[model samples]
Target: MAKFYELQRAMRAMRQSALQRGALAILDLGSTKISCLILRFDGLDPSLASDQVGSLAGQSSFRVVGSAITQSRGIEFGEISSMQEAERAIRTVLQSAQKMANLRVDHLIACFSGGGPRSYGLNGNVKIENQIVQDEDIARVLSSCDCPDIGDGREILHAQPVNFALDHRSGLVDPRGQIGNKLDVDLHMLTVRAKTIRDLAHCVKRCDLELAGVASAAYVSGRSTLVEDEQELGAVCIDFGGGSTSYSIFLKRHMIFAGSIMLGGNHVTRDISLGLRVPISVAEKIKTKNGGLIVTGLDDRDLIEVGGETGDWEHDRRTVTRSELIGIMRPRLEEILEDIRTQLEIAGFYELKSQKFVLTGGTCQTPGLDTLASRILGQQVRIGRPLRIHRLPQAYSGSTCSALVGLALFAADPQDEWWDFELPSAGYSSRTVRKAVRWLRENW
Candidate 1:
């Protein structure tokens, strides 16, 4: 925990340095495509902003200087399967983006979707040392949180203090500067396999780029796509990616849980390929051009060419009705929705006051996803895309690039995390070190 605390603090410093330098790279490592966004932070806006996060005017805070997206290789379920291949893919996109931006970027923030993410709820309570809460009190309360055993080889990726309560009043976003007898805090800790993080960091380092910050794909996309009412009351954001589907639960504008499913859009493509006896590429094309979960009376008349490479003229020229395509895809899509429903059930999502569900990600645009999802998951389901950002290309303003867009916003102005505060470690609390620093300053 101490080592990770220091590592997080160091990354915070690196993020500040990146912002100061004005160019920060944002990377979204997806299974189907690897996307990169370069943001230029020129100057602050005059709009009134929250003290915790400097600016609320999202669009004006940062401009997209450069962007690139390329086919992903050696990546599956959002984790790097082949180090060299993933690194090569990363390098390819970075070179292209830097060329477009006409500027070199050293500091980067990245997001990924794999590594078996798990969430835990932590609680801590402490009596106020002074009449009002301060930085040390915040740090002390966070440090006092007793975390459960997250299993071996897993490390905490996001440990955010989701809610703070003063005495009996709950839902306090910031307890500092407030008078309180006792401070109670609720933390949302997201953990992933340590090897996943280490491999990602190594891959970034190999690319000659610094990984200033890392985020969970599920969590960041939720922040970007879920609206204020949905997030504030309660909502489930399911991001359908290429190789996996990531889901996060948000309440009171904070994520309480996040997880990933092994199956995603690529699975649907594979099913189409097998069902239609077409190549994977052809199947993907067909799926994108015509796949849907709904079957209408006219679907039987709608025909799609299932092209093949086999020399047999009849076999190569086979055609299938839209009804047949939907039949082949509906089962798999239902399976995914059923799995998501079961996961939400396990997370106790049904107990929340609001059951809003927002679906985003590239695959989330599958023709009849919302209609089918509403039937399988719940009645309150809507397809979502990332919010518009400053200087973002119109081409990138779709559900397909939800994670990339979210990563850009995250890189621009991030919300506060536990690591943002200086903790009560020996380096922070040791009197001898403080005295030595003071004495050196006085002597000099």
Candidate 2:
């Protein structure tokens, strides 16, 4: 724990320096592609972000000056499978984005969808010695929470103090400066496999970039797609990426549970390749140009040319109807949705007072997916796109770029400093931790 927090402490300083320079790059690494966005700050104060921006998921006081995306290589299920290839992809994407921005950025904040994320809800309470909730009380109560055994080789990616309570009153977002006997807090902790993070960090290092901060795709995607009202109430966001699908549950403007599955849109593409006896690339193109879950009579007549290789012209130039394509896609999509449903059930989704599900990410663009999700998941379903960012290009404003745009929001958000709620342990940097809490109190 001390080791990871120290890394975060360094990242906090790096982020501050980059923000002071008025430019920073945010990268979203996924199984399908890697996207980079360079945001130019408009002389905005971090301490006044939420108040000035009005809490829109992607509406922060930052303008995207440059953006580039490249096909991901050597990544599976959002995790780096080969260090050299992943590093090459990162460098290529960064160079392109930096070229467009005409400015060099040394620091980067990255988000990824792998790591097998798991969420834990923890609570702590402590008596206030000064009869008022202060930074020390916040730290002390946070330290009092019983840390769960998250297993060996797992790293805590996010430990956000979501809810605060004072004495008999509960559900306080901030309890500082309030007179109280006891301060209680509800914290949401997200953990992932340490190897995934370590591999990503190494790849960034090899690319000659500082990994200032990292976020799970599940959590950050929810941050950008769920509106303030949906977050205030209860909402679930399913980010359907290429190799993995992540789901996050937010209530009271904080994430309570998040999980990911290895299954995603890529599996459907594989099914198409096998079912149509075509190459993976051809299947991918077919899925993108013509893919959906619901089939109509018109689809039966909609013939799609599934091009291929090999000397057999008839087989190489084979064609299939849209309905046949949908047939191959729907079953796999249903399996993925069923997995999400099972995860939600395990996480007690039905217990949420108002469950709203928002399906986003690159894979969600398949036509009629929302309708199928509504049938399998629940009636309350909507296809969500990331919130509009300031000066984002039209090409990158689709459901596919939700995580990248959301990464921009995460870079602008003070909530990334959740590690500031550290335990009062030996060698604790009290001043630094207190500074993070102050920022959250003033801005978050």
Candidate 3:
């Protein structure tokens, strides 16, 4: 636990250093595409900024000075499958973005969508030593939370204090400077496959770029897609990427749960290819141009040419009705949505007072997806796009760029994680005792 906290602190310090340098790059390493964005900061403190001037109040302190994207190779399900190919792809996108910006960046903050993320909720409390809640008190309470054994091959990616409480008062966002006898905290920790993270780090190092920070794509997607009201009340943001479909639940403006299904847009494209007897490339084009969940009566009469590259003219001139395409596509989509529904139910999403579900990412661009998601997930569903950032190109302001945009916002104004506070070196052994006491107090 101590080693994990130390690593997190080091990463945080690296991110702070990159920010102080006034420039860094954001990378979204996904299954189908590799995206890079160069952001230049103006040395302005986000807390002093106005909402009207930035994407999020006190968080939009950077502008996109350059952007580049390339087709991902040797990556599957959001994990690097081939080191050489993934490295080449990363180098390509970074070089293009740097060239566009006419500046070189040595630091990068990256987000990815795979690695089998698991979420755990933990609670802890600490008695005030100085009769007032200070930074040390906050740190003590956070460190008191029991760190669960997530598994052998997994590592904690995010350890955030979602809620704080003071003595008889609860629901405090911050307890510092408050006169309280005791301080309590509810923490949300997300863990992912250790190998996946290590592979990403190795790839970045091979590209000769310093990895300043890292984040889960699901959490960052929720950060960008959910509006303040939805986040404050309660909402689920589903990110449909090419390799995976990741969803996160937010309450009180903090992520409480996050999970991902390995199935995503790539699966749908493969289904189309098999069902239509077409190549993968052709299937992708058809899926993008003609895919839909709803099949109208006129669709039966509408014909879409599924041209093949074969030299035989007649074999290349095949055509299928729109209804046929929808028939092939709907089942897989339904399966994906049903899987999401099951995960959400397991997470107790229905119990939330506000159960809005927001859909974003590249695959969510398919026509009629919002309507289909509403019927499958819930009625309170809406399609989401990334919040606007300063100087962001219109082409990159869609759902597909949600994670990238959120990463920038995160780099500017990150929430307080466990490592942000100062914990005493000797506090590790007391974690189990604190957990037992809290359990007894609540149960007895």
Task: Name the lDDT value of residue 336 in candidate 1.
Answer: 90
Residue 58 of model 1 has an lDDT of: 53
TM-score of each: 0.92, 0.90, 0.92
Global lDDT scores for all candidate models: 0.87, 0.86, 0.88
Error of 3 at 146 (Å): 0.7
Q: Candidate 1, after superposition: displacement of residue 434 in Å? A: 20
Query: Which wins on lDDT, candidate 1 or candidate 3?
Result: 3
Candidates ranked by lDDT, best first?
3, 1, 2
Ranking by TM-score: 3, 1, 2
For residue 335, model 2's alpha carbon misses the true position, in angstroms, by: 0.3
lDDT of 2 at 205: 85
Worst 10 residues of 3 by lDDT: 50-59
Output the better candidate (1/2) by lDDT: 1
Q: Residue by residue across 1-444, what tens digits does model 1's lDDT show?
A: 445556666777788888888888999999999999889888755443344555564556788989998999999999999999999999988989999999999988889999999989999888887769998788778777887899999988887789999999998988889998999999888999999989989999998998888999998898889988998999999999989998999998888999988999999999999998899999999999998889999999998999888999999989999999999998998999899899999999999989999999988888889999999998999999898887799989998888888878777656655567777554555678889999999999
Candidate 3: TM-score?
A: 0.92
Candidate 3: clashing pairs of residues: none
Question: What's the TM for model 2?
Answer: 0.90
Q: Return the TM-score for candidate 1, rounded to 2 decimals.
A: 0.92
Model 1 segments more than 4 A misplaced: 1-5, 45-54, 424-444
